[model samples]
Target: MFRYYFLVIYTVYMLLKHIKLLYELQTLDPRLSYAKQMEAVYDKPKSFMRGCIGLTGSTVSIHQFGKTPKGPVLYVHPKLKLADLAVLLGHLDKTPSFFAEPRAFRYPLVHQWLNKMGAIKKNGGEHTAVEQIEEIVRKGQSFILSEADGIDYESLSSRLGVPIVPIETSGIEDMQKGSFFKRLKPADLDLTIHRAYLPENKRLRA
Candidate 1:
């Protein structure tokens, strides 16, 4: 009786191991419809933009800014405008938006805000800053208009070999409105704020 019982337990253990192996094989099979469905669900989008916000002390309000397929997008606080936020969120394929370091003059307040939003880290060494920007650019991204002028933008554009578009925010009124769901139209200001930063190749292409 004891010998018979031992044989049955051993057989059951082997059978269970084989069943587990079969389940794993089914999961690993690419041709399986379930596997294909999983891939489709997790696939990344092709065209995505990197959004940035630049805050100035003189302005007293933060700006929502980013680059788009056509060019740059500049407005006020995104969360304050439901329509604009919807437009931005719709455009996000799979890429992320990053707010780079604000100017040194407004470091204290800006840094605190960024920390709360988890947008950026405190300013590290020069080498680290370069590495951060390079990594973001390599991932096919662009920054929104903060203090990015001609020279700073030119340096970044040359290093990344990508065009840096500056979204102009001079003429966008109603940005200081009360409701967070306000409507916004494109401003009619001169859009050539960082024209000098554009590369020769990009200019020729344009």
Candidate 2:
């Protein structure tokens, strides 16, 4: 009886694994599409104005600031209009978005597929700018904006095998001169909402 039960459980586990992989494969196109759209929005090849957006102090307000040689100058005010924010985030319903550490994807098969499709590249050039940022801080001088001018953030993220947010965090840590980070709690909410809900059998394993 014990041997029969063990065999049945093993079979079910394998079945669930393959099923999950298949479902991920089906969603590949939408994921790729969203990635492309984000690239289009954030990175304008011909736009010469270099800027970054961040929260201003503890206030609820935020600032879109131009990166300058001396310091960041406020370029835009308060908040984005509802319509503009919606246009920026319109792709959220089509697919899930979150920050994943470099080379640490929850779905290995999906990561492999993305690489095969040329959605991201893992060349040695990855993190070159990140390392440069660290070195600039070591010399006790400001790393001016011009140092990073003309670099495409979307392309850099692709090469680094992660999202742009991680790059932001990397620069932040270097500026603060230490690391203060913890892994965020993982949940199945994105999977469920995106209609790629995991099989019950694989939940615990995942």
Candidate 3:
């Protein structure tokens, strides 16, 4: 009876593991349309992180800033107007997206379980930007803007090898009605995507 039960449990565990892997595979994919844009832009490549961009400090208010839950994970990127940032993400092909061993368990459940069982220590603690390129930030899709923004943010960009883009948009009367950033009417937003950063090099522009 015990042997049969053990075998049954083992089979179920393996089946679940396979199912989880498949689920992780499906959710972790680059956006197709955005992927094309990334290839074109990168062919004439502007920055190391082709799709990701950094926003200005003033624009960071649109997001709710808070610390990430402490576990085996690390919190990167501050946020604001994630919807707006979505408009700018670049897409990548499968080749560049997954060229290495994945960082965390492709499935969050496995990551959490292993961490709880003391099988894994510090989730994001052991990861590098390359492993995450396919997991968190798709190679092609532009990055979601994070919390704090400024010259300091260049460090994160440098680490990720992505570009920084600052946008000056119109139609801000509602957001900055009482402040100096207020505008009366909608107009064309001027956006400049800065050059990409190499992890080991210094940039000419500040």
Candidate 4:
């Protein structure tokens, strides 16, 4: 019985140790820089312009949506080609902003896409997504990208005066379908829980 109890305790301790390691790795992810940049632009006032919003789906679906009256007249479809996104980013002459969400930094793939982009100064405060959108527009931001799959395009379009375009990518829709808790596997939850214990950093890396 003692031996069995010792084994159980050892297992639990190892599991916790694994969780700590994962949290550390997540904090070190380079994409966190991108997330911070996005946050900065969303919250602050700066000279931004030509702000466009995009909703991604399958490439074929985007084409079909574009035909309708509600479809965006113009957009960029990266189609999971980071190079394409990079080119579009270059053309913008500024880093695009992102909708506020924890997954923006926590998810590597999404952050990888947004990393190293530009960011405006921060206004600082808890703001709703709609409010952030308005703030970004007021500051003259050119584009705002939603978290991969969490935003309600219809609700946002109805609330805002700007046009919300559908820009289809090959795999992004599926990739971010469950970016947060709903998507996490049982084994991954421990790391997420551990992340919450870390001190939050409000000021983004420059």
> On TM-score, who's better, 3 or 4?
4
Off by over 4 Å in 1: 1-96, 100-118, 125-127, 148-151, 170-173, 177-204
* Each model's Cα RMSD: 19.8, 19.8, 17.3, 17.7
What TM-score would candidate 4 get against the native? 0.29
For 114-175, candidate 3 gives per-residue lDDT tens digits of 22212222233324433443233333344333344222444555555554433222222232
Ranking by lDDT: 1, 4, 3, 2
lDDT of 2 by residue, 1-100 (tens): 3323443464345435555444454444554543343333223211211111111011011221221222111111122232122122221221112212
Please report, as a residue range, the 10-residue window in candidate 4 with the lowest summed lDDT.
189-198
Better of 1 and 3 by TM-score: 1
Off by over 4 Å in 2: 1-110, 124-206
| Most lDDT-accurate candidate | 1
Off-target runs (Cα >4 Å) in candidate 4 are 1-87, 91-95, 99-127, 170-206
Mark the regions of model 3 whose C-alpha exceeds 4 Å error after superposition: 1-79, 82-134, 147-171, 174-185, 204-206
Candidate 1 per-residue C-alpha lDDT over 9-58 given as tens digits, one digit per residue, 9 for 90 to 100: 64345435444433343344555443232223222111111111111001
Report residue 148 deviation for candidate 4 (angstroms).
Answer: 3.5
Across residues 124-193, which tens digit of lDDT does each residue of candidate 4 receive? Answer: 3324544655555444343444344344544544444434433433332332335332221111100000
Task: Estimate TM-scores for all models.
Answer: 0.35, 0.20, 0.28, 0.29
Clashes of 1: 1
CA lDDT of each candidate?
Answer: 0.35, 0.26, 0.32, 0.33
